[model samples]
Target: MAGGLLGTDVVTQIGIIVRDIEKTSQAFADFFGVEKPKWFLTDTIDKTQATYRGEPCYGRAKLAFFKLGNLDIELIEPDEHPSTWREFLDQHGEGVHHIAFVIQGMQEKITLLAGRDMPLVQKGEYTGGRYAYIDTVPQLKVAIELLEND
Candidate 1:
């Protein structure tokens, strides 16, 4: 269970696509009785990188994260950039986009999924780590994000 690839039955974060981060973050904070979460602009992300359908691509989004007990609730406001967030908002409207798992062997997990036909849809690097969103809808019913935190 510890080293297995995610979507083998584990979820670390619940990500929701929203239209407005300020409004939605405040709403969720108010409802959960917690302080407003800090929002991060994807524009500031370092080592930024992405791909769509196996081709190089780019996207921007505003994100906020709130802790709810042991799990995290993430809100994403897709900007004009072409990204998974934008795609989800465009196709499905605002809703749950994906469940994430912090993995140890990031590339290994990605390769395993890729072997099974789950192509990497988006990827980017931040301060201490990187993340990749896999198009795993066919089997998992939702995308799965693999994170490697330093």
Candidate 2:
């Protein structure tokens, strides 16, 4: 997977953390002249506890998925919990949090990144794909990930 990292697609989505999901979605729609995105609220979705830097972290997030020519511009609003986007929200106040790149083999890529000591910040799968993140640049307050077809 490491050897083939450069063989996959480019970073397709630039995720932004927004305060008002609907307003933000509308703004992006107006700016891009497109339809409103598909919104998914995750505040009651994943209940599993995850480890972040050896500490327990719990949370949920709501997302708006905007499809744009084979790419999705995602707007995320994090629910109350110490999620990865918590700091990004407090510091930047609703802006880009991460860039998602689509790949072919997610677990294989996860193993490759883990071997490099870049453990997953969190991982999950949805209808379109499976995704896993790495906090390689934690200070940047953003995550880089591997998204592949499920």
- Top-TM-score structure, candidate number: 1
Question: Model 1, which residues run further than 4 Å from truth?
Answer: 1-4, 7-10, 44-46
lDDT tens digits, residue span 23-99, model 2: 99999999998888768865333543444444565666778998888777888888777767676697779777778
Per-residue lDDT tens digits for candidate 1, residues 13-124, read 9999999899999999889888998898765433565665565656778889998776899999998767789999999999899998887777888888899999888887
Query: lDDT value for candidate 1?
Result: 0.83
TM-score of each: 0.88, 0.76
Error of 1 at 150 (Å): 2.0
Predicted candidate 1: what Cα RMSD to the true structure? 2.2
Best by lDDT: 1
lDDT of each: 0.83, 0.72
